[model samples]
Target: MVRATLGESSTSASVLCRSDKINWQARNKPTIYPKNFDLTDAERIGHPKQTNNGIYFGIRMGTVYGRLADIHNATFEYLRPQGGAEEPWRIGDFRGYNQAARITPIASELSTEIQCQAEQAFACRIVHNTNNNGGINLDEILTFMRQSGMDTFSLANAYPCLMLTRKGGTTHAVRALKCWDTRDVTPLYHNGAWHERYYIGMERGTLGDAAQLLPTTNGSWPLTVSVFLAGVLAGDHFDLHNWCLTNDGNPAWVLPQAIGLYDACGKSATYTVFDDSPSGGNESIWRVYVASLTQISTGIRFVINSNRNTSSTTYQLFVDVAGCGSNSKTFTMPQYSSTNLDFTWNELRMGPPAPAAGSTYNIRMQIHSMSGTSATTLWWEGQKTITIQ
Candidate 1:
């Protein structure tokens, strides 16, 4: 039996190209040289053959000769060996040999480039923009976060990823993936290294030392002087007015006196004095004063002085306190002429209820004549501090 040389020997023959020779050999021979070839055997043996109309079976190697361009264009599917033991099977044309092996290296390179680009973008957006063009500062960013309902604690608790790069100094890059713990007190970290800082520190300094640190701009001096003088004048006037009310009488200073006395008494008292004689009318209503108090046994007292002109009439006085709760008292004054009337309201008689500590309380007073309303008028109305013991 005449046999044709295979592989490199068949390709080396100058008279005919490999494809033409293989075709001539197959047609001329009684049986193909390679054991009466079968597609199943080709697959099992890791060799595939292309035959009749571009059909392929199993893996394709250089065994079955064809046009070089046709062989290159023909699609083949087989397992390509990777670094590990298991090879991954894939399908593609000749150009895609060992495609899976190329993936990881390319991916690693791309990942590094992407990370660098991300860092550059972050620096441009945050550091460069912040330092130039009056962009946001760290304080402003913190303020915005707070306004958006994020507190320092929240920020500290957050797992924010940051790629930090310092410019203009010792250049370095830090990547903080997820590192922050803000509860009471904790240290900060940059790329696994502890960052030292303090929210509050007590450093030795004096008033003169602080004064020396003040900016020496021309406008600063006038601003400082104006603020100092305004504060001094305000303090002096406040003291003088309060002192005068505690000693003498000033109708224009009545509310200020009440507030000043109330504040001096630890905000536990409500004081008000009104002279209704100027209007010479039947009704007198005073403005409300807000006071603060603790939850304690308290009482309100009023001094009512009737003018001689107040005819035979019954006067009704009302005291209203509103705050965490509401309370009101009405006093009945029988016919009286030029007489001093005293009324007291203990906690039991008041309504709704006494307020908790630090709660604001509003006090309002009103006086009117019940009988003979036209002729009767209240000469003076005064509020004494409620006893809180």
Candidate 2:
């Protein structure tokens, strides 16, 4: 029988071979040492074995583990196959994952199923041309959406306010309910931004609508309509129309020019009279014609033209118009006959009597000689009217 005994030294191993009468001690048994090896060499030696619930590699220092267990704290260095360079890599470099969860896909890599899933998740429709080499066109996508019943203009009317962002990070906000094409076939530039040849619809009631005055048939009604002017410049004029109710509860349009005027000269009549009589005559000689009057919130306006008669002659004018409290004014005749005296008055106190709309009143002017010794003739002309808004 042969017997073999091993030594305890780490650097060397001593094997004692004994058989029958022959005894021998083999000292300094060579020990296998670990050395830096290339991946090809390691693989040749049957590395990357499953051990302790982990993929481990027997390297120069110790075993290296991947995933399966304690991967969070593992660090490793990899050699470039052709570059002949080593790069240190750690589990943290890959965010503690063995593989990437997401990866950018090329155009050819996008599958039909993935595209459909993306469309369903994002609520967006995409248009692509596999035959063409050009990139995606946003304008074409918008056209597709519009054709598919997702009209951008109508969207504003339905949602009132909506914001949409495109794939290229371009964003658009719905500002109006209607969209109009521009007269110029090209796009328009507004506020430093270029826009397509379409105008966003204005908010309802901003430009006024006759339908706003109509009463609702059911449910709560909106009593007021608001107008908003966004970024409007000065001197911008807006034409408005007046909607009036007809006898049959229908709306009637009144043109701006068709409205009746009630200015000083409007709807006014003038009268001229020559009074040649001796002084001391208290009776009024000429009565000015009364103008066709209408409802007036403010006091009335009058224009009087009178020739300057002989000096020392006093002329008294009385405004005996209806709806105006009794008021009298006196003035002395001018010395020169060529000089005419013009008088105007706006009565603020004793507010004019409130009159119903379309109602008529009479406004008259009378002139009398207070005192004059010689025979003096007075030529007087007067007009009366009121201003309408």
Error of 1 at 236 (Å): 52
**Per-residue C-alpha lDDT of model 1 across residues 6-49, encoded as one tens digit per residue:** 22333221222212222211101111112222223223222123
lDDT of each: 0.23, 0.24
Off by over 4 Å in 2: 1-298, 335-359, 372-389
> Candidate 2, residues 292-366: lDDT per residue as tens digits?
223334544342322121234566655554664456556665432222322222452233344444544444555
Ten-residue region with minimum lDDT total, candidate 2: 113-122
Worst 10 residues of 1 by lDDT: 256-265
Q: How many backbone clashes does candidate 2 have?
A: 2
Models, CA RMSD each: 36.0, 38.2
